[model samples]
Target: MLTDVLKPEKTTRKNAKPIWLMRAGAASELETSVQDWVDASAFKAGAGTVLVVPDRKPGGIAGAVLGLGDGDDPFVSGALASKLPAGDWFFDSPSTADIRLASLGFLMGAYRFARYRKFPEERPSLILDGSLDRSELVALAEAVWLARDLVNTPANDLGPDGIEAAARLVAKDRKMSVRVVKGGELQKKNFPLIHAVGQASQSAPRLIDMRWGRRGAPRLTLVGKGVSFDSGGLDIKPASGMRNMKKDMGGAANILALARLVIDARLDVRLRVLIPAVENAISGSAFRPGDIYRSRKGLTVEIGNTDAEGRLVLADAIALADEEKPDMILDMATLTGAARVALGPDVPPFFTTDDAFADSLSAASLIEHDPVWRLPLWAPYLRGLSSGVADLCNVTTDGFAGSVTAALFLQQFVTGAKSWAHFDIFAWNPVAKPHAPVGGEAHAIRAIFAALRQRYGVTRN
Candidate 1:
């Protein structure tokens, strides 16, 4: 049903054109291949190289060879998207049957968040010849694009209330139930951490909850940090640090997008999405770094830094999710710079105490081409969050291991869930790459969705 929007043409198949995806390496190993075809034709055969070779046989049009980056790093194969000429193309090989990566690259290449401006014409499509479900691929692409668009929008258009409205719209469209605790209601609800971080913003802080699916199905709870704009509260970020803060709610966008996919696919699981939307703005009433606040989990947290507000809101959300003792609890946040240091913008780092859940995620990530690496919820880092006056600190004073400590800080409130995982995502692309132009990005969303599918055994119609 979702695939109706992306009706395929007969030409959108691998056999439509013969294309070879080539990898480059040392000259010794890089003899005549697709790379040679690119070089011979005078086309730059660097990473993301797309070369069209004319058929030597009379009247036959030459097939194509997509140049992956230097063979040393295969992941950059996605770079080939930039090199291909504007036309439809597909992978030539049948042995590499898992076409999800190619599909992912295709969508990633097509992404351009040009809300303020117009997007350039998209390059021709690279069709996969394999038997993988075309409809699923289209749905996945649409979901990722949806997440990116929501992230790329300015805070003026996607503030806390706007984000809640979007969630409600999605819920209404899907015939799901939705609830929101806003303004004074958040205080009544005892979401003090959520209130403390967002009270200064005029838009008002709110907790968005959306639920769908049949009763008795395994519960899958997703919590996302929704810091719509991080002005860094009273602590304040330097001008450079705050420039792109509007993209701070990327985690919220990602969860909502993933939620849409699950509902669209009619997955056989009870799903709940929680987004604590807020703006970490500065005002006389803004929460301060030294302030102590009570969390929904009943834990007292000392504000180690106002800039670390993402984790604070996420803590309250995760705690509320844990109250349900869901089968799985996964929380996403653009919560730390330390994670970016450990792994670049492309690779999101996740931490979990459950070994089985981690392995499932690892396998799903590889299969989906939306990979995430696991970091330890190493208990030793717990000491970093100790507070002199409160039960814990929202952030560690020591600059080292900030990501790990942030994960650990959130973990303190997750007692009821059977399994819990935290994803520290960058949710942004500083520069353009093929279809994914510079703007907000949705990292690790696909992988987690794949894992959920495996966990619930999604049945196709």
Candidate 2:
């Protein structure tokens, strides 16, 4: 999809503009003519600043210069795709790592939601001459763009059926196996929690199960919460809070993004993707706050709040994922507002019982620029989720630790997996950054993918 954004070549054209990257106060070291032009233009090399120098020949761009502020973060180069004039461009760098990072930034920056903007902008193409692997970077950009597109679409166009359609498309594209249990089949299948959450909507609730890779490979299961639109059922959210509810299915979009990376890279993993698709809308049949539903895992959970439906759907899905006794289980959800309050929108909070997996994921997060922070699955918080009648409630009544208790609530259904982690992600970029535009965003999957690849990387003899 976005593969064309990056062009691989044995050599770059002489006319291709060389982008000279610099930190503050580094412009004085440039060649005499370029330095004079930069100085004359008062280019201070501030972060995200770009200035195109004119060639000695009239009206032509000789090259461009970019500012990196402290030179610590290379992703500032991301803005170059939109800021630079349409033409061929190459980074004037000797370091492989910087080039790689800068290239990634450029590829992501090239994204434009063309669905609504029918006319395409004249885009600049990055020319690479043996600096990086084009395939992996292209795969990352394509997957991220796919997730963003799904997240940015309005709820009218993206409902429960829309989410299921997306999963079906992936299965067809990859030629993988897919099985769906929908409507009354969900009831017959014993997915009581998932059905209860969506029974109020016209679109039926369903579980999308997709599998890929060899049967004997290490099992890696991914579960995503697919609440297409959360009207909060009978407990409706205020207008302001419900305005962006379309992005509620962000967790499902991100799981598909990561699944693309895993399958495209041909990793040595037997992957199972489980998506519980539903729409939490209000109606006469809507499940009430005090209602208790027996999950597919046979754990009774009292509905403490109607707005906490993400975990309800995911509980059944994750319980199903654990049934296979997979080596790892990772579920991502736009489950709680408290997560945003705790870490803001950019840094998601992940909870896991495995120390080694946490350390590996943390390391990968920084390297991949997909930030995630670890929150404890505090056993003491288990008391916060305790219920008087049922086995456990969906949320803590005191609300002292909303995000922590949410993770603990999901952790109850994951006893069978060797290692399990829950990613409480925002999945939406409320504010625009140099690289990421505002709307549905792909978070944490890159880092998670990198870690999984390292753990189960295929070795060919």
Candidate 3:
């Protein structure tokens, strides 16, 4: 989609339509002809609204006016890409908005998941102005598109093996080293929790490990929960709850996208990505709700509910990541519905003990327009996960603080990392927005990337 729309040329086309961006109060200051058109069309410069001006010349469109609302959001420029008629378009004038952000928004807005479509519609093209970094914009858009594509694919086509294949593609593209531990190898390698969760499915559970960058650099480890299709195991979800189960692997998709951005930017950090890919399907071999399993961290976990399998896989992955004592360990998962209940799908809730890290992430979230709200890692909630038969229970019986308890569960596996944070994200967008469509969405990754760039002193140049 990006390749079709974003051009490398800096020069505007002879016949390309001029897209004039306007804010609400500033419409009165426009050129007489444009102002007349705005008045005639009753264009108020409301966000996501577009006004087309017919051409005086004998060809395509003459120009267009895009609403900027109060001129606060730069990403509103994305609306023009989707709303405009099919033709070449260029920014008519410059403003205070970041050119890079606007360009990225345009590319992202133009994205379409046409892999299964028999007839995909043609998208409008934009002539690049050379003010933004084209390479970086393309890379970011492509990474985001990849994440969306992975999440949008159904479980029937994308299971544990499919996830491994996707990881290998990323590793191959970046020249990184990748290793897969699968089947009996997982049990031998002490990933019992991962094995138990995925044992019911014919598609074997596996661990995907990818490493890159210089060994001596500050280690940054990422762990993602990859449950391709969650049937809730023996404790199955109702029909409505199971409808979008294909998107359960959203966390894995997001981490891989972030890794791509980090590698593409060549950040001065040794990157390690661990994904515990599985399917919580019910079968004769399905792990029962009352079963007790030993985790990679040496903690005994009693299965209070098979529906809480995401944390189980993450525990083993986080334990392995902690062994290296990375400078920072960041884990993302679509682990709990309680997070969505508290904050809704648009805002992901994050948990971290480090104050400075939280502050940085919060600031980055604002700057990147990727919303994330901080939730307390309240130590008191540890009591909720206590088990009578084992060291801990996979889920709290009361179901009071589901998101908090899940974070607490994963936190037990990490003692070595200097700093650690967890993101409970709903990867799917329940409804469409101007810049993001309703489908598999990449949450918090941009904010994390921005934070990493600032922390590591990396530049967009």
Candidate 4:
């Protein structure tokens, strides 16, 4: 639980510390004494900078002033989780800041992937003064932490089997039903593309299908490309490119995280999470680059590059999800390095034909502070994936608009869903930030959740 770092204020402590959060312009408006102290100490109110004030009574500590810079950064308070002194603390003036966002920032900032650590690190705690919904904040933080944990775990401990275990854990908590289609079962179940990708690995590839919520509720299907570890199969990736292949399954981790949020909130929607879990390992049995395989959707896909296995697995899962003709279908994948090259690691690029949906996602991205940029499913790029031997090639040969081509390839498998959106995400944060540490980060899930809430007219408490 996030209670270790974020807790509701039940009773006041006699010596509770105060944290005075301030923007640069507001510093001058502080009480005369406080302003004088800040000026004398050369505190410029730069973002994330802190200055501890001494109490009037000797040997006691007064409130602390934290810089908010221009007050534009929603996650400015995140830095305080690591910077503040130990003990209970609360916002000096609750109305001066968005308490919910601040608390979330602090909780996320306090997160550490200490599962395998010999010595755990201590994190500063914040006392919520009932200004925010405790359950909602905790649920969101836990969901994000869950994604980080799944992505940070090595492939040795988190392969196709491990991915299934994680989904089962979430299902067990929610009393949801889970079905696994594995090994020869995948072939019999018509998940040929998914099975083909994992045929080389000793661990059987499987489709983890989890369902929750009332049967008659509106259907929302989520598909994630769960390439447990992408060794690029027979094509193989360069050693440098394969260093962090464990995170190739980041898409599955994220969907599971999003599912947790939806289930914990008990959203008024029937949710189906489809994860095509596999490892694109190389061996004599590995699917070859020249091979053509029939997909679950019945499209014969020519293998343009065996390394482009994420879209193949996702194609099968997306087809399965679309078969139900859900109200909406959303799929996420760390499928293309081209996406990372186009948007960098921080901004994930989304693809959808629905203009209004794109606009809503854009609005949610800004409001949720979980940024995502929309990239076109350019029809012109469809020719790039043309194959003479089959319905289409798995990838483009020219290497232009690689991300767009990948999205277009997946689009071919979806014929039932009313609306579809594909998120090509670099789920790993490459650098440390105020609210995000340099490890597996949950990209775009929060924004998508916010959009879902608005669409369903569900309000957070």
Candidate 5:
């Protein structure tokens, strides 16, 4: 847990070393001896550069300096988490970092998915600022850590049942009520699409629903696509495309993480989370291309392609969420490769008809340092989803506007909500960054949480 690396006591200890954040051409701010030492060590204070000075009398270390180059992102302090020596450290005076963001970044930098590997070395920990909400910070970091851990785990270890088990753990830890409809029960419950996707896998498909907070509070519902493993079903993905199918369930992992954040923060809202867990594997019983199925919302869908399975499971779950017409609907899925091509993996593009909520998310994304771009929910793309055989098709043949069409397909079942937004995310991080490693990542949840907090005042239970 990244939160474990945070010192319980919020004040800086006397024994802890001071870490000064400096930028290029900031030599005048440093003390005379420190400035001379920095110059002697050839430290120009570029971003991610580190220089530690030694104490002459004690023969131990004195303090260290971190270069922030222009320091555009306050969370740039994340880089220092693994760079500095193992010990208690604090950001010192004459530094430019925002204490709260830097502190959060420090925790993020300390994250490691050590479930499979052995990490014998003790990592550095921070004495956090007293003014910051310690509990909130832990909740934020732990939410992201939980998502990363779930996504990083391979399919052999985490299937639909594995996802349900993890949700049970969250329910136990967060004092939430959870119920599941698995196997044939999903079909009886009007979730034929979810069953169709997972019928081929040995692990049964499931619908995991978790609820929390007061009954009359503002209703906020979330739906996530939980394709445990996508061998691309009968259509099949090439070896390169299927290499990282283990992360197909990243949307479920992330939304569950967000649920954890909501419960931990004790937000004043009635929260409901729905995850349609399934594995799109090949077998004699797998749903084949050209198969037509009726969705929970009574809309018929033609299976144009078997690989486009994430949205299939999500459609049924979103329809179920719309049954009661909740205040808002937000569904997340690693649903399209076009999203990656449009905005790349680092910046997930979001679609929403609610302009005000989109603005809120934009502002929150900037403040929280969680990057997300708003893509239009173009109504014109709806025609591409139309089918002569069924009410709609799972995918289009032309392959143009893949992301937009996918979002439009999910929007068909969202008539009852006050507002609805969809996120097409590439959950896997292809390269390492200062705050995160190259693995499964929690993309825009922080920004979304921040927006929700501002929207609904913080009157926690």
Candidate 6:
């Protein structure tokens, strides 16, 4: 259950009602009454105008209006959650409006990473009118919350085992079945790359598998990189580079969050989630930079740089996902610094060979307001990953197109999926935004969810 904030002094309609409104370009006929009230009333707040208005219509009660001073900023619609009075309120408008994205955004925007500290005050609540499906909205919010919570938890408590445990807990909560292949089990499962990277850690390495939805539905496979903490293994990172390595597994957190949404929405698809959980820690037994390992896909990879271990683990997980020959495969990872360099921290870069799939995802981002940009899976970049003695190298020899090369490496492992998409997300908001506090964030999950919903339609709980 989510927390709500409501003041006793605030005026309410017939039922202690709460709703969110958008102030657009010039007041329309629909908003004429509200606009007149705002012009007449004097409020102290500047940007986010939260006030209860009188609604004397037949079944209507008091309504809440959120101020978007300038109509130019599109992100303002979702940022209203931070300013409104705290309470579990629903939207006052009809559900026919395409505002599910804003509903999810409101929940995500109001989110604060509070494990390290307490919030100064309660956040506002949101309620949607009878139009949109409540369960789908809640599922989307919960999934994003899970991603933020797992990524925000300090590395000390969220190591490899802890990550696996979190996935299991979510599986149990959703009444889904899960299987964990850990430590020696990796050898049995034939996921050598996943085991090699995690063997050096005391926490042990694990591959988390979760299944949900009807058995006969279309299969949709999701793989996430779960390097809980990256000390850069034997290669070692500079102090600055290592500072936020705890968020290295942010890819895994985001995927699990998306998985939660899929199950909660009950989408008409057979969902499979694979998270290769590991910690790239330094130790005497840690896999060395020159080591060569066989992947589950049967391709041999030479470790050019230990820091490029996220793809290695994901390679095995993707191979496993491919074996199912799913309709689509989506893998998320905080895999490359180059992606951040190209798009900065907020917009993640995704790669896919299927044109229709790419368009669907791109359009869904615009509709959902959880934007992700597309980067080509340039076939020419395949040469950058060539190895003298192995099928490929984990990194590029000249250090160019790091994100592209990383995507190319993972592509080698995907064989049977009809369509595949890879996301290189920063997954952390360095600075605070209205809905997102400065901490681990779920960058592309919402966009992907929107695409899924469009493809398969929403499934209610």
Per-residue alpha-carbon lDDT of candidate 5 for residues 1-461, written as tens digits (9 for 90 to 100)? 55457777645488888777777875457777888898898888887677888878685777888787875766667787888888888777642336778788878878888988888577778987666687888888898899999999999899999999999998996778999999999889899999999999999999999999899888899888889899999999999999999899999999999988877777888999999999999999999998999999999999999999999999999998998888888888999999998999989999998999999999999988899999988898889888999999999888899999999999998989888999988888898877888999997999999988877765445
Candidate 1 residue pairs that clash: 24-71, 48-79, 48-80, 55-62, 89-127, 109-435, 110-435, 111-435
Give the distance in Å from residue 271's predicted Cα in candidate 6 to where it truly belongs: 1.6
For residues 81-139, write the lDDT of model 1, one tens digit per residue.
Answer: 55555566666654454245555565566565566777446565556454667667776
What's model 3's lDDT at 262? Answer: 91
Taking the tens digit of each residue's C-alpha lDDT, what string does model 2 give over 128-181?
647578788878888889899999887788888899888888778786799999
Q: Write the per-residue lDDT of candidate 6 for residues 94-135, one digit (tens) a residue.
A: 545435655665766777666777776766665554456666
Q: After superposition, how far is residue 211 of candidate 5 from its true place, in Å?
A: 0.4
Instruction: List runs of model 4 lying over 4 Å from the truth.
Output: 8-14, 25-27, 57-59, 94-97, 118-121, 458-461
Native-vs-model 3 lDDT?
0.88
How far is 432's C-alpha from truth in model 4 (Å)?
0.6
Lowest summed lDDT over 10 consecutive residues: which window, candidate 3? 92-101
The lDDT values for all models are 0.79, 0.88, 0.88, 0.86, 0.87, 0.81
Q: Write the per-residue lDDT of candidate 4 for residues 213-246, one digit (tens) a residue.
A: 8878789999888888998887878999999989
Deviation in angstroms for 102 in model 1? 2.2
- TM-score on alpha carbons, each prediction: 0.88, 0.97, 0.96, 0.95, 0.97, 0.87
TM-score of 1: 0.88
Per-residue alpha-carbon lDDT of model 3 for 256-333, expressed as tens digits? 999999999988888999999999999999999889999999999999999999999999999999999999999999
Candidate 3 TM-score, C-alpha based: 0.96
Q: Candidate 1: what lDDT?
A: 0.79
**What lDDT score is found at residue 15 in candidate 6?**
55
- Candidate 3 global Cα RMSD: 1.9
Candidate 6 positional error at 322, Å: 1.5
